[model samples]
Target chain A: MTGWISEFMNHPATYLKIGWLQISVSNLLVILLMLATFALAVFLPFPKGHDDTQEPRT
Target chain B: MSEMWTAKLRTKWQKELPIEKLLPDDQPAYVASWIYVFGVLTLSALAMIIASGIVLAFEGPAWYHTSDAGKFTNSMHFWSVQLFFVFMVIHLWGKFWMAAWRGNRFRTWATGAVAFISSIATAFTGYLVQTNFDSQWISFEAKDGFNSMGVGAFFNVTNLGQMLLLHVAFLPLILGVLTVVHVLMVRKRGVVPPIDAEPALSNRGPQ
Candidate 1:
């Protein structure tokens, strides 16, 4: 099990470089994930609760 | 009518943050957005970090390096810290776009900003105390930056004992206090309404 897991995990890291700015592929993926999550949070409909129809408090 | 200090303090506390406000059963309708959930997600990650950190502290560095159980616990701590930062950054982004400081909530935003900085410092100390070649190299490299900034004399990142104490005790205390104050401020001020929501709700300050 450990051997298989280690084999899977041990891989050369890929980095993206744009001039002096460089970031690992892993880091870039995480950043993209964050952006996607933020977009989803904005657009996704929230689950309705008992008070879903309540008037907006002023 | 007593003028005792404790009584006066109690009255002031109640007046400032009554129980209903502190543990509100309901929030404004605009708060139903999924974006608002990231704050609680950040807090959950922080709780996981503290729990895993406590386990790591109990076992020490050598055990974590050599033993399976300790290594698992160490991984838990590492992953928790990662999640904490990820959730916290998302929360920060959400709050920033929302203009969370509106309606006299500048202190809320300020405390949260300070807490984020404190958390970074805490994570830096944690890295320094890792008792590995990575930590050694990082400290050696970081010292120059600290020295250039004129804070190396006090911070001393290379000193394991100082870094360990700072990570486990000092920074956590500061972060905890900031988090409590931030949450209380949120409760007191109420959630900031959406940008396009009612003008009156957006302008409503602390109660």
Candidate 2:
């Protein structure tokens, strides 16, 4: 279990070193992508006046 | 109390969601698309995850990993989370390709996206509390990212107690509230029509 798990964890880890910082490509990419997703979702301008659907009547 | 606030709240809700629209026995013809079902599937998975998680929380991790009943409940929780992510991802992609944000539905779209992010955060805390090598490694690795962002002091991923509290308490609460709001927004706004969808006969002229 230890051998295989360790090997798998070590195998795909593409590490980066910037000064004293150490990180993996996968981790960095995930963080960047999540931030971008949040930014786009929050900051994107709504395309107004395109709504033609009738409002739900009470 | 005069019940004024309660009466006003009920009136507002009724104004936004009348009986037929709130609990409709029917949907538009276009609702036949399979892609639309993913949202409900994700909701079902979330419900299962929450129920299973409650049981596991009562049992604690010791029983969860050791006892047969606990193992079964834990498996249910794990698989439900997997199903939740699977259904949610498909739902997200479907919305993207369909441009489900059209028709002044940006709030509905934004809520879903925010819910997705919240779910990921909850899942990360869930991983941190697993009490295994995987969890330890994950926490160690994630701590660096948090520290880099100056959030590690507040959000210590390596602390099992904190992670467990976050997983079973605060994070789940946030996720649950976000999910409820997301569903309510969807129901209130109604689904956006498909791109290039023709206007209804009522909107145009009698067919």
Give the candidate number with the greatest TM-score: 1
Expressed as tens digits, the lDDT of each residue in A7-47 for candidate 2 is 77766678999999999997798667645644554345544
Judge candidate 2 at residue A21 and give its lDDT: 98
True contact recovery of candidate 1: 0.68
lDDT of 1 at A37: 91
lDDT per residue for candidate 2 within B1-207, as digits (tens), equals 257999888887888877766676666555556667778999999999999998888888899998889888988999899778877887787788777766566777888898899899899899899888989999999999999999988999998999999889998888888888888777776765666674442133111
Q: What's model 1's interface RMSD, roughly to a tenth of an angstrom?
A: 1.9
| Native A-B contact fraction in model 2 | 0.00
Can you list the residue pairs that collide in candidate 1?
none
Please give the distance, in angstroms, between residue B159's alpha carbon in candidate 1 and its true position after superposition. 0.8
Stretches of candidate 1 off by over 4 Å are: A1-12, A52-58
DockQ of each: 0.59, 0.05
True contacts kept of each: 0.68, 0.00
Model 2: how far is A1 from its true place, Å? Answer: 10
lDDT of 1 by residue, B1-207 (tens): 479999999999998899999998888888898999999999998998899899889889889998999988898898989989988998999999989999899999999999999999999999999999989999999999999999999999899999999999999999999999999999888888888887777777877
lDDT of each: 0.91, 0.79
Q: Best candidate per DockQ, number?
A: 1
Docking class of 1: medium
